[model samples]
Structures are given as C-alpha cells and as structure tokens.
Target: MNLSILYRGPLSSCNYACPYCPFAKRRETPAELAYDRRCLERFVSWVATRTGDSIGVLFTPWGEALIRKWYQSALVTLSSLPHVRKAAIQTNLSCQLDWVDACDKAKLALWCTFHPGETSRERFLAQCRVLLQRGVRFSVGVVGLKEHLAEIEALRRELPAEVYLWVNAYKRQREYYTPEMIADLTRIDPLFPLNNTFHASRGHSCRAGASVIAVDGEGTIRRCHFIPTPIGNIYDPNFADSLYERPCTNDTCGCHIGYVHLDRLKLYDTFGDGVLERIPYGFGESKPFLENLSHAHLSTE
Candidate 1:
C-alpha cells in the first residue's frame, strides 16, 4: 500500500486529563493552534506538488480537531488536494457531535475515539446517528482496558452496521486483561482490528527515515514524535528536494514513529530487543533548525 498520512496537532482543551496522554497537562493556546494551521497548509501544499497524487491523507490532531476553529478550514484545505483521495480524523467525539454538519461539509472520514468515562453511550450514539445522516463515513475506537471493555462492547453493538468499531490497546496505562475482558472484546467485533501499532504488540520495524516525515507546529521536519531530532524544513524553498534524504537519530522509541524508523533500517529485532541505541557518531551536524520550524517527522503511512 502507498504511504497513508497520520496528521496530528496539540489540542486546545481536554475534557479528561488522562495521566498517560502526552497532551494531558497541556492547555490550549489559540495562538499556537493558529500557527499550526499555517504550518499545516504549507506542508500539505508542498506534499501535493512534490509527492503528486500518490498518497492518502489521514487528518488527526493531539487533542480534538473540532475544539479549534482552524480545524474545519484545515479539513477544507486537505480535501482540496488531489493526492488526498482519502481523509480521516481521530477525535474524541466531543465537539464534532455538535458540528456534524460542518464536518460533512469538509468531506472527511471521521475516526472517533470514545472515552466511556468522559463520554456517554447515548451522546456517542447521537453523534453516530448524525454522521450517518450526513453521509459521512466513520468508525469508533475504544481504549482497551479492563474498565472500558464492557462499554466498548456496548458501543460496538450500538454503532450502525456500516460503521466499524475497533479496540485500541491502552499503552500508557499497562493493565492486565482479565479473561472476561478478552472474551468480551472478542465478542464485540470478532474481526475488529487496531489501525495504530503504537499500542499493539511490538515486533515490526518502521521505514520512517525514508518514507515518513512530519512537520510540527512550526514548519520544520523532525525524526519522529518520540525523538526531538530535526531533519529538514517543509517551509524551506528546497524542502521538496530534500524531504526524503533526512536521517534518523533516536536511541529509544516506544511509539509507532520509532517502529517505522527502525523498520526502515531493516532492524527487525523484537520489542525491547532491537537496536535501541542511538548512533554513537551523532546526527552528523548540530546546525540550528529554522526558527519558524517546530514540527516533528510526519510518519510514513
């Protein structure tokens, strides 16, 4: 399959401050969110012309896209690209429920992450109903944990047949799954599969060095979210020419970004057993990244 895009940004507000969430303690900054918009536009436009109609785009942000005013416009911009034949967003089903009509206007495929404690089954179902009415495609994901397994199963049954419901392993909080919980998850959607590998059982190496690239809230390309290594700048005039040649410099990676980078190295050591050490020779340079660039490497699809 061609590289699919997984685009994310920091959220403006978080209803539930999950301890494991990276942005859990982060407060929303409208100014930073707005800057993210400009950086996103520049990155997308550059990708369109450089890659040119060969990839699918997945729209996602750290918090929730609907919480920011620029998200709707960002969706509009992404849909305008011909290379962006497919578009999806990972959300918490909070604000989008209120603006289902606006989401439909953006021609996006919605990927809703349901938090049972913070979101109610009735409210989630209401949003699903609205999405179906708008003719927008969507799916539901429940964080896999002993606490939410039952609720996840109920949501799966409650979702429309056309909408797929899957379970996401709760990585930040490592909790054992009871046999009952496993049985419950298996019964919810027998064919249910996780789309994100970050929380999945680790084994695969990632090809992010050559294929995956990300631009941060600024416009610079970095290695991955887990590592703070800078590679190139999407906003730079020469970005298109240098996008694929950037190098990886991370020593330890738990997220999918690390997996992709390691995968590209053809280092298929199993989880907790791979070449988890950084290059002793360094990243080869210590030049300053552009002041306007702050984004990390956008992982390869």
Candidate 2:
C-alpha cells in the first residue's frame, strides 16, 4: 500500500539544550549509538524492499537526526528510490549541507526548526543559503514564543519571500501567544493560524490511521505519536493490511502531522501535496507526485 510514514529513531542525543524541549543535548554512549545505527539501517533496508509501493517517509527523531552520518546516507539513499515520492526529515539545520549534494533534491525536503539562542543565527542562515543555491525544496520554521517574536520577524525579513516560513505552537507556552501576537506571526507565516491551536478530532473521520502513520525505530507502527497502540509492524508483511479508517480517540489533536489528516480540517485545501513534505504547495505548481498519490488513494477507496 502507498503510505506516508514518520520514523522517529531511538537516538536521544542532541547538541542543543533548548529550554522548551525536554530531550536536550546529551552524549550518546558508544553502545547506544551502535544500537541506533542498527535500528536505522534495518528501517532503511525495509524501505528499500518497498520500492514498488509509493511511500513518503519523514524522520522525526527525538533528538537532532542529521548529525549522524548514517542518517545523512539514509536520506540520500531514500531519495534515489523511484517509489519514494517524498523523503524528508525534521532537523535543526545544524549539520553541514555538503551531504545534500548526493541526495535527490526533488524528493528531499527539510522541516527546519530555528532556535534563537541555541544556534548562531548567522551560521543557520548560511546553511539556508546552501539549500537555496542547491535548489533544495525546504521550509524554515521557528517555535512561536513571545521572546522570539523579534527574532522571527527579523528572520522573515531576511528570508526569501517565496520560501515558506512556519510557526510551531509552543506546547508549554500556549497562553503566551495572544490574538495580536498571532496576527504578527501570521504576517510572516500565512499558515500560522493552523498551528496556533488544537482542533477537536474525536469521532471525526481522519485519514491518519488509514493513510499516514508513525513508525518507531523498532519498526512498530502506530496511528500517531500521541496514540501509542501498535497497529502494525512496518517490517511485517501484514503491515499494509493494518491501514484502515479510524476515529481519533483524543479530544484535540495539535501535532501538525497528525491533525493534517483530519478530513474536516480541510488542510488539504491549504497544503495540497505539500502536506506530506512540509513544503508549501503553490497553486500554480505541478504536483505530479501528489497527483499520482491521489489516483492511488482513489483506487484503494
């Protein structure tokens, strides 16, 4: 079955200690690093076997993932696959950009998060320049925090107008963003309102479980990160059959990746094919990959 999978590796080590995040910078033990490498390789091998089936994969690691050499190699490997319409990852953009030269930039995209104090703004912007020069499709984003308002606004000014800049709602500081603040952020990221709050998802028809899902390093697949019940195993032959429509069990779904599948949200109207890759889908652009996936979804229905 054609699927969109978010794979979060077991790597818990990060290089940044942002106050907003729990899993801060920590050193990974030699043994732990080895184990993580094995798990990631297993996932890569499994994905290779699914070459005939359409699959869009996003690596959502608990910690910074791009720092690992294997992860870099994996991104290049996945992008080269014909069936992999989208192979993207969430990163802090702290790593070197030279590795991207090996990737199929057409299928590769980055959901980059810019932390104000954690990284040097100049260095981050320089890396962004590399992506633009290489013609890589990517999106720039920052956490929506009151303290970071000025930095975000300044970033928006320096960033290219055509590039999509997203604002992620900070979970711990939900009350920090007032309506006026949202308006300011919205000016930089037109899609800011969508991320400002969680939507009621209970009993609503969502394509989450049936079309998109989360896969842990162990290959265990879940409907979403918030929902931990293992619906199937990614490596298992029966994995494809595990996909089916199910109502959200939670009251409100906040995660962009999860809520985007909610049919009622009509996120498709805004995101279009870009939802899968975390890039803006311009109305005038040709979404051939998404066009193919639409036909696939219709056939399955």
* TM of each candidate vs. truth: 0.67, 0.92
The residue-by-residue lDDT of candidate 1 on 1-301, one tens digit each, is: 2444445544445655665576654675667666776766665665566545455455556766666556665665665666555555667767644444544344466667777777689988898788777776666667676667668767877776546565754455444555566566756643222212232213334455345555565556654565467666656866545445333444444443254245442322211111121111111122211111122222333
The count of backbone overlaps in candidate 2 is 0
Best by TM-score: 2
Candidate 1 regions off by >4 Å?
1-3, 10-12, 16-26, 44-51, 96-107, 172-175, 189-205, 240-301
Give the alpha carbon lDDT tens digit for every residue of 139-230 in model 2: 88899888888999988888876677889877665487777987898777766666767777788888877888899889998998888899
TM-score (C-alpha) between model 2 and the true structure? 0.92
Alpha-carbon local distance difference test for all models:
0.53, 0.82
Candidate 2 lDDT: 0.82
Error of 2 at 75 (Å): 0.5
Worst 10 residues of 2 by lDDT: 292-301
